[model samples]
Target: MTLVTDPTAPRIAIVGATGAVGNTLIELIEQRGLRYRDIQLVASARSAGTELSVDGVAYPVHAVEEFDFAGVDLAFFSAGTEASEQWVPRATAAGAVVIDNTIAFRMDPDTPLVVPQVNAHLLDARPRSGVIANPNCSTIPLVRLLDGVERRYGVRQAVVSTYQAASGLGHPGVEELREASRATLDHPEEVYPGKEFSPSLAFNVIPKIDRFLDSGFTLEEQKMLQESRKILGLPHLDVTTTCVRVPVVNGHSEAVWIETQGVVDRAELVELLAALPEVTVHDRRSPHEFPTPATIDDPYRVHVGRVRVNPNNPRAFWLWLVADNLTIGAALNAVQIAEELIARGTL
Candidate 1:
């Protein structure tokens, strides 16, 4: 493959180059063979000067302060919300279209919040804000399925309980969980000194993710409700969530209970879910055939299983979903958005 860009390729930049999502972005770009005129790896000051390889070519990671965005056509910002708030405008001002993976701009009226699979049509033109917001990780997988269901059967409400992984907090959260797990197994009484997770996450689950808002729902939970409404184009959609942080090192799962406007058939429901793009529903004859975070075969696709209609209420049903938080929830979705923009000649 040619390392130099062709005339049509865009020059791209990856912010937060040292984070989990950033790493996954680079991997996906290579895996999908995204054409780029040039690629820049950018991170905070501390991570600068380190070199990372994209497609076997080592490029020095640049400090955000030093990275120039003047000619960059597309930028993917996986940095924290604060970083996006601070640096995204600079990138946009310098003529880069930003695909941000943060809560900062998802609800911005000028910036369209997008999950390409669910709402790629929003990318028909560049937004007024010069940025495209990637939805919350938990919201992306949920909306992808809900979009099709809403179109087919009409969804009235959705109740979701997410089993999130430590990786959602990035590399530090994963490191802390593993270290804490080791410490707990060796010394059952002493607590591991943790700055990433409170009360420790060793063999324990935390029902809260992000800060608690005034409505008794955590910020992460609130993101799901609001982001889903935006992505699905349902202003009055009902979605209540309980976001939990589990001990799993990667992959996030959700147990979803949905109530539709009309009766849903079990066999038809399985076929409908299976027909959706990049979705796998494991509903064979075996009782144990269900998608779990640990058992998912494809990290890039949303894995669904345990499809069953409510016995008493024909309008309700339950299902299980597993997605790679780093991939489907963050990097893959961002990459797919870029693909859509490129296809539309908007990038």
Candidate 2:
């Protein structure tokens, strides 16, 4: 966060600097040691006068309207879809490359929807569009493993059910769940009248996330399907998901059923998955070996367990995975994309 005079390193800006993902992005930048000439912290006008520190040096939050993007060589956006739609173009037009964590431009023909683990080759050159889209929280971890399976075993179909955390909605959702849970515990007969999510997320689970589309799938579910195809470069890939909002607080977990084109040996499959970069696999039968959201030791890595190939169908298998939605699913991915861009001199 210190102002450096290195001309080769990009001068960076973080839009949505006050939000949860924005905070996580800041943490990762310090942890990963991404080189930057200087940094700008931007947020809504309401948060403008506040200050946030990066690398222990405090930086004042600038209102998006007042911040100039001209000198910012790299800009990271996590300020929801509407904000990205409104401000991203202005940032890009000012010669800043955007690493966007929104649905705004993921499907744009010009913007590349990226999950660096699977298709980082797309970042070898500057994108034709001034922006790069980060995949959905759940889509990211799923595609990371699916890419490995598809290359070695040839994935014919992948059916996943995501048990997403409250943090997927960011801080407000987490606060609502906590207050509602406390309220429920205090008075079991009273309804909390929570506003963050429909029904309630206290001691309960919702099968739907985002708005329900005409196709009957919620927008969250649809993003998983469409984003996977685009990120994996599989136009017609058969990947289906049921996105559920669980009572947990931060990590996202998925139960995947993948049917491959050929038979797969369980041992080979476990070896294959563990070989993936930054992936941890628990193939042991011991009950304590599997990973849970609270049990994940490394927030930066993808955790997979219960790797069982169907005995009746050797070509089909079941696996469970847990990942920090904030890190692997959002902030870390964006930072990794920036790292790749910097290393490749694409920024």
Candidate 3:
């Protein structure tokens, strides 16, 4: 394995710079005060020559196909799966570590699916085909909050229902939802086709997320199950999920129930979560406080609340978790991967 020395900041590249998560990634990179000798933003040909401003400085978005990756030390890819499949290898071959945010390489054994707070050690292991995969937006926060509980008392099964925002589908979905709401208020006609959603998302909640599979689960639900197992290193864990699309603009929330092998005390669980780094526990019910999508927007911390033992199941508990999908879910995880590489002197 080849390693780059310390004190020399790496050259970083962000694919799909104009996209929602891509823009958030750049904001985080600057906010964290990360030191990179050079930063390059790449997008599709249609968005080429676009200028994105960071800290009052403008950077031009280049065409991905024509951008050279020769000197790039790391590439943060937030583009779709097809683009990642086509360009990640090219960047890797040019000696850049690729932290991919799409679903393309997630299930690949050669790629490490990671959430930094939960599995930072995964990055310490040998580089897997020069690529690392970030888990789905909903899955990332779920696993991070549940990891400690799973470690202390083994988790046998889980049931999750996701309240996803319009941002999960990118800018067009957000625009559609916003436009649909406006049109509905003014008049009564479908703003977007029924193909986009079975029911109107404006002032409505759709229980289905992504296309359904033969196994009677939507692709988004399956991703949560499969990715959770992989990240927790429990291949046979029984996980069931129902992913929903809500009218919220940002942040993803989940109501999770888990059955554990041993008893888990509610108070102790609350204390543990509060002490965990990057996790905030808000269990106060007197004032009716809890983790809400509106409150957790743009934050890296995953907030947990409503922790209690299930009334029916003796060894089961219920919890609520929320986080900014674009940050903690995608871009922040990618940035942490790069930070990990630098801290470990692997770059």
Candidate 4:
């Protein structure tokens, strides 16, 4: 697909427009003051005939099977893996560059898995297969910081534990959390019963995010290790992860520990991390302040804090990280890739 060099006018379509990530994409478009000649909203049959208003302008949502993709220069897809597998080729064939937010093509060998700030250069290949993938939400914020570290001191091993928000499952996940919360309030001592999340997600944390594999790691956990390596170009990096589903409604947080190749100092590390434009360092010793998922206000930046150098291993360090799973981790990254394509005249 070819995009007009004119920044003011590029035809764009957002698939799964009524979904949480789709809504977040619309919000970011308005917030970033982006201009487009046309913006189309496409979704499933049930969402057809519905209207979604962005920046005071309402765009009618159409079913994907019925929507024409010919004029679309760029398409942002947040639909499930099944839908992506079916429609992405059609969209690309219709001359639309697809930025898919599903696991469908992430490890496709040909399709580039991109987090714009971390690996925007990968998009330079323009998906010889005609599709680019947005990495898993949990992997997005993690890799952004790791990129900086890998560029400087060379990371050798890492461990990550995630506290994923209810919103990770989309609108249904958020609603389920709300229902569970209400039920828990009614019966203070009773465990809330819900199938959407195994065990109750209210007043409790689920140690598992996705289904467990034969290797004992959940799919969500495996994605973190695999996607991190691909994004950082470290095919054999030692990485392990434990993904948990927390009751929070908005942001996803993680605790990360890393061992670099060389000795490092806390002060120097913080200075280097702070210099990354997409990362916000909230570390401070005196006031006992740090970043938490709930305390983050801006949805675009990843918040990092609690920088600690391992006393036993000076080459190792630990930190806390947080980001909006729907925005920066999903929609914003897709949009940024589109913008990067435009900047590099690849769209």
TM-score per prediction, in order, is 0.98, 0.98, 0.94, 0.95
Clash pairs for candidate 3: none
In the range 1-347, model 1's lDDT, one tens digit per residue, is: 32454868889999998999999999999999888889999999999999999999999999998889997999999989999999999999999999999999999999999988888999999999999999888999999999888988899999999999999999999999999999999999997877899989999999999998998999999999999999988999999999999999999999999999989988888889888999988884443589888888899889998888999998999999999999999999999999999889997
User: How many clashes would you count in candidate 1?
Assistant: 0
Candidate 1 Cα lDDT to native: 0.92
Listing every candidate in turn, what is its Cα RMSD in Å to the true structure after a full C-alpha superposition?
1.0, 1.2, 3.2, 2.5
Write down the worst ten-residue block by lDDT for model 3: 1-10
Steric clash pairs (candidate 4): 3-347
**Model 4 misplacement above 4 A:** 1-8, 189-191, 284-287
Give residue 217's lDDT in candidate 2 (0 to 100). Answer: 89
lDDT tens string, model 4, 269-314?
9988888877888874432568888788677899888888999999
lDDT of predicted model 4? 0.87
lDDT score, candidate 4, position 204: 82
Per-prediction backbone clash count: 0, 0, 0, 1
The prediction achieving the highest lDDT against the true structure is 2
- Candidate order by lDDT, decreasing, is 2, 1, 4, 3
Candidate 3 lDDT over 253-311, as tens digits, reads 99999899988877777777777778878884322468798875338788888888877
Would you list the C-alpha lDDT of every candidate in the order shown? Answer: 0.92, 0.93, 0.85, 0.87
Candidate 3: residue 210 Cα off by (Å):
1.8
